[model samples]
Target: MIQNNLEKYTIQLPKKLNFVLKKIDSNSNGIVFITNLENKLIGSLSDGDIRRGMMKNQVTKYVNINSKYINKKPFFLNYNSDVKKILSYLESKKNKKKYKCIPLVDNKKVIQDISTIESLRKYPIINLKIDNSEINNVIDAMKSGWISSAGSFVSQFEENFSKYLGGGYSITTTSGTTALELALKSLQIGLGDEVILPNLSFAASINSIINVGAKPVVVDVNPKTWTIDCNRILEKISSKTKAIMPVHIYGQPCEMDKIKKIAKSKNIYIVEDAAEALGATYKNAKIGLHGDCSCFSFYANKTITTGEGGMVVFKKKKYFKLANQIKNHGMSRKKFYFHETVGSNYRMTNIQAAIGISQLKKIKSLILSRRRIFQYYNKRLRKFNYINLLPENNWSTNSYWLYTILIKNLGTKKREKLIKNLLKKGIETRPAFYPFNSMNIYKKYCSGSYKFSEKIANNSISLPSTSISHYDQDLIIDILIKEINKLI
Candidate 1:
């Protein structure tokens, strides 16, 4: 039988100070713990607290000081308490202060030394099976000794994915970013070309544009769905604009029909960055099917897990052959060292393809699960007056890869306070990405108003979104509510 009762522990508030010094001497300057006189239930300290405390004291060197910060109170809860209840308690504190990991304390005010919500919750580990699939399908290819890149599974997987997404031809690559690069290269979009996309997207999108020697024309995302505005693209398009790579972000499809219409009118190519939008549809067609070429990621964190893999899907056979050559060092025929064009090595292994096959079969179930989780958050968090959930458009159904929120008038102090409070109660949270223009690398490249993106960068939060149980979900909502309630 399983037990969920509170245990007793103690913390010697005095010994914790000495322990901090000992840890520092062992070259572990940042590590901190909590204990009682008998090393029972006391709270924990951290390296951050030590540094700040020393800095406040004007002590540059490590000298023993009897400041209360050394025995500072840590966020903690009884092991048996309802996780949501503890999270609520932490949220109350976080909306007002700054902190890191909270401790898990039992009854008798004893600290358990455990610091992370993942550790406290003890989430199940996903067993990674690299190459365990039906290998018999390739038995004939193996017998013929054509194992390198001519495996049946690769062709079959590509064919199946292409058919599934509608008449597109699938061209596999070693990674998703490379697929983007190949797609751009196949269209002859390079150097003098400029492609438009949203500022709030993965770094891979930017890297792919650069890889093809093109300039990325970043624009602010729509405040509602965090996607590039289809209408906004018209103003940015010029004779120098060769193509537009619209990212289907967070598993939500961009307004592809509108984007396609604009591209067609302007006689420009369209490449769909479907890395995060696999299985997402726009106007009854998949995003991949709507563009000249669409790229998909098969990383472990993606909807489908293939260790590290990617693919580019398009309608034309000509583009498929060009992509194939682009991925294999710009060579067309085997056994001949003749180079047709400049290319790089970006081929996915048979082993990765094997895993991808199984994952692809499970894609429908995975998307449904993620959508259901998103609905749960929507239902619960909708009650908060200050928080705005992501908006849905009539053109597409969101796969909702990540449940995000924007807090109205949430400043840095309040945001940090809320995070600290949530952490103290054994809850985890991550802030939204800073604006692309604000980043050091793109300050010179980007030129325009980004007030919308900047607002989200400061107010947005990415809640826990692993494909798992809702055990921590309720706790997160409760904590968020408590923090927001305090501000009101």
Candidate 2:
């Protein structure tokens, strides 16, 4: 079905019933399409058809192709048919039998290829939904010769994104990693300083700390929320501790009140890795508003994207000004080319910011789309007793960046097998991030056992959470259940 050699599933019309049966047995599915001498599709035959023919006649193997066993009016689609049309035929109510494999034919009814459920489209873990606005803005920015960081869109994006998070100062960066590094540099958290963060997070969170000459103190995450365990913070804290970087994993906001109280009491900073939680909230307040510095990623897979960009928001103007200066090589604003402090090039291009502005205009709908996808997965997967759904606490609103679930009693090997089997069926899945301390490079940071983080990393699978249609979601769910059942 995926434009390969489909010869095994095709046979000449003059072939005997026994030959057709052999072809059906040899093919991946239990079916074969019959073609004439001109290679024009004439009919189709299945194992069941041969069985019925044998039951009706004693000498079925000797029966020729003109018998009643072959289905003459087989369902198919034209080669030019689009994905929507193919999906319509597959989901058509008129067909009593759910079609698993449909032949794609030329205008003259010659079998050009085959279309299986998987061939309809390769459903990715994340699909970017780009409309005309983004394209036009990028074109406009290019035409205006302001494609670099000096253009107006950069400041506009910063202002718009800051206002989106309830009034704060924002600085655009080349990536979320740079934003985190900039935030640390602006806060003067470097050299002998230590940053406490969850072990179960993307590498960027801890990498930023290490990049800024700070030591990373890895702690485990809460089993239910999959967020940094608030109770573990104090135990890992030391006199050199300068900040507690809490990652809002998979778009679920961390328990900010508890983290805030801890940071306030210890006289430490709260730098939020809100890269995956753009519109997420805690206690009805947006996530970026709670921390001293909150960083967001605008990667292609995020809720809103600028292709390869990030933003860092600050609660104080001094930090914002320092970050702005540092983001552009620490050049003094008043005196051109006068260096104030050593800094790196971490500026977001105007073209990327133009795309960001367009994406921001549709942020609300994008957030809603992600929530709708989470709800769909929740409603369906809740019936399965073996599944643990993604957390959405009563006090917080999850952006549901990726709809993740954990299978009870499933181990790492079995989960990997499940992911592989899903891939074979054209569904993509992501395993949870391996605990930081589990890696040899971060072993020096390992202080305590990370039982919960390891457990989640072993059993959790993040499904496709982009703007996929309900039909695609149904397919993913069905294949996932079948594969998970087979593996577990």
Candidate 3:
């Protein structure tokens, strides 16, 4: 087996032979990497080199205390080298599996990380499903010459989305961020207002609050659902708290009932950031209806894609009207350029809406596929007891936007290495959103520690989750199983 203990596998040149042996364990198969003061990799020292140095000493152990048998020309990979290339290089070596770990170095040869062969597999993670239907719809919209911001397809997209979600007004926007901005703006959240949000969410959720001139009150997330901690929101709420932007992160619902009760009592509005959760339902109720207004993203990677678009779903016509006015540069539907209020140009194109309309038609099927993908992954991975697959409470249905797993005892460094390895094999994996407190931009605003968010961010890895062949999934699982075995 490759000795993965880096502390035992790295050293500097001219170290005392005995000391180096003790450090790397003279009998161990581990090799010590040597670096200069600038942390540039020079070479690697094997245990055999140490034994040979001892043998070369004419006076035996008393003759020389130093090692001169270093392999000055050791193999190392450039940092961020594709996993596939590294695997090809390793397969050519004698001990293919054991020699798989390679030092990833910068241009100056400074160590960045390590990649292993087991983590690199040929099976891909996710595949985008854009076939004839998407193409046909876009072409038809384009040929009609109504591909601009306003068109019949835009209304059709909004109508279809609302109908798909069990009835609510849907206001399409250029992007998810714009949709969120419109929702918050409709609620009148501006200067001196605070929006309670989970620190574990994507950057867009946080940015929208800042975009609306509202201070973001960072709250910890629930470890189980990886959603906003409803309990934590109370302590962060103040007189200035205007809204709770609960992001249904990675296709799971937050404790909506409890959060709704809290919001109702505090008289604070809720703007559900359902960017990653398009079709998820909480307690038999679709997500869009619970909040004062909910937002959905149709970014290429979401459960459904409008290529680049989002929707603000409103329960009340007033909010929808306000969002529509804001989206169209304050232009009223009746009188064009009859400026109503200071607004923005966040309108979605008819071309995009046409695609969205087509995509929304298959929303139910798409979500079912996502859930099936999760279930498939869960079934294969559950036997690996140490892995925590994405959480799904009894009351909620997951959209499984990205199938996520948390490996116990794995930290950020190892998690990244694992991801790099997956990338080598053409499998595209991503780390979970880093905690808000972990980011420097949010440092000035963050008050207290977010313990759970930190833990989840460090340990989580997201698998590629799209429509793919069962064989591909099985191959992914097989390789993943092999890699997880090494983690223990």
Candidate 4:
């Protein structure tokens, strides 16, 4: 029987360990993790736990055969215990269950389980704040007749974008998808080449690679940041590996510093799929600064919107020229109607740029507004008895385009029901992006069991994150709590 108060050690259940492992399926090793309420890992449960529980019939047959079972007995180790002692304890626990790891109860515990999937499962669902004041600037630009993509507003938008990233040349494109294609084409990465990316990103990123006749080597994500694990890149790297596209997912920036070094060592190109990350920075350097070419999305739901637009930024002057020409349908010299390269029409209209320019000017305020909403929701929703707030660290600035929250103990089916209930109350909520590996078109290209992705995918829902009002927040929160309580 489990003791309420463990003397030598205090055995406590993890708040998010199960959730984390659900996001990143156990590797072949079959080890599960445990973390505290703050998301700090306390210990691990091993395959042995599963085997023992099954042998003893401690777990229900209907329960997943793969799931780990925690021993009711308190497992404890002193904080001062060394690695060897910790290993000994784990070995001692080994039996028919074949458990290989035991987690420490406290920070001082000898072996805290940091290896579990739960330790890495939390990510912040942000609210990308919009600047209300920038609206006036855009209105002024519009009234001044600078309402097209080619006007001074476009230049201002590009200038502001570049300045935000410490000075990179920015070329506006019509959409995020087109922006990626523009980047790939400008970098000369096409047929006979392979571009490696995450199966977790928006399909647009993958589609861009395929559009250029380049094969996409899709890999799973880290389940922590929901970004591609850099280690996996080498396994897929080949002579045909022309570029590595690490998508900055869910307002979290990819580990660009390490990715850059690896790409350099392999002599491959790095393309920043910053479509979801407009104001996000990496090591205070900003995202687009690292890639050979970087892309941003200005879709309605993005950090900023020009209704339907995107931009490609780069340091290379040649790409700027190529992108400009390519976005203009391959026209170089108007007099001779010179077509320098085969390209398509992917230009953002001046009208879109005009709005974008206005939006850009108001980015800081918008970010702050989103942050405010995030803090409020984080503070309020997290206090609930049956909810788990996704985690976010300060490594990168998250522009919360959508606010995500994990409904504790509820599966996807239940989450769907919750969404239905919220909809009835006029409260809008969304699910995080579906696992890309599950998509029919990309299944063949996907490798590995996206256990973590599948698990979180089931229980998670995104809340409305529009920069509205505190009143809206309170109403949504009240409705959500009421609906969830009824179900819980």
Q: Which candidate's TM-score is highest?
A: 2
lDDT of 3 at 366: 83
Residues 264-365 of candidate 3: C-alpha lDDT, one tens digit per residue: 999999899999888888998877889889999988889888888999999899988988888878777788779888899888999999888778778778
**Candidate 2, residues 134-194: lDDT per residue as tens digits?**
9999999999999899999999999999889997899999999999999999999999999
lDDT of 2 at 315: 95
Write candidate 1's Cα lDDT for 1-488 as tens digits: 01111221222344445555565444332445555455454444556667677777743333333455555455565644544554444444534543333455555555544433332442111212223343443344456565566666677779878877877889888788988998999888999999887787788898788878899888887777678877678989989998888888777688777888999999998898998788888887766888898999987667676667899997788988888887888886765677898888888766556667767776787778778778888888888788888778787887656667888888656777776666655455667767779888877557777878778777877666654446556756767788767864
Give the residue spans of candidate 4 off by over 4 A.
1-149, 333-336, 384-386, 485-488
Q: What TM-score do all the candidates reach, one by one?
A: 0.71, 0.80, 0.75, 0.69
- How does residue 334 of candidate 2 score in lDDT? 94
Give stretches of model 2 more than 4 Å off. 1-114, 117-119
Model 1 bad stretches (over 4 Å): 1-150, 411-426, 483-488
lDDT of each: 0.70, 0.86, 0.79, 0.70
Runs in model 3 lying further than 4 Å from the true structure: 1-124
lDDT of 3 at 46: 70
Alpha-carbon error at 408 in model 1, in Å? 2.0
Better of 3 and 4 by TM-score: 3
Q: What tens digits encode model 4's per-residue C-alpha lDDT throughout 1-488?
A: 01111111222353344443343243444554444455344554554665686697665533332335663343555432343444444454533332333444445343322211121111112323334555565677678775655577677778888987788899988899999999999998899999999867778999999999899998767766767778788888988999999888767788787788989999999998999887877777777888788899988788788878999998888888888888777887564577888888887776677778778767887777777887789888877867766557677767665677777678767777888777655456777677777779878667776676665566778886754456557757877888888876
Residue 154 deviation, candidate 1, in Å?
A: 2.1
Query: Which model, 2 or 4, shows the larger lDDT?
Result: 2
- On a 0 to 1 TM-score scale, where does candidate 1 land against the true structure? 0.71
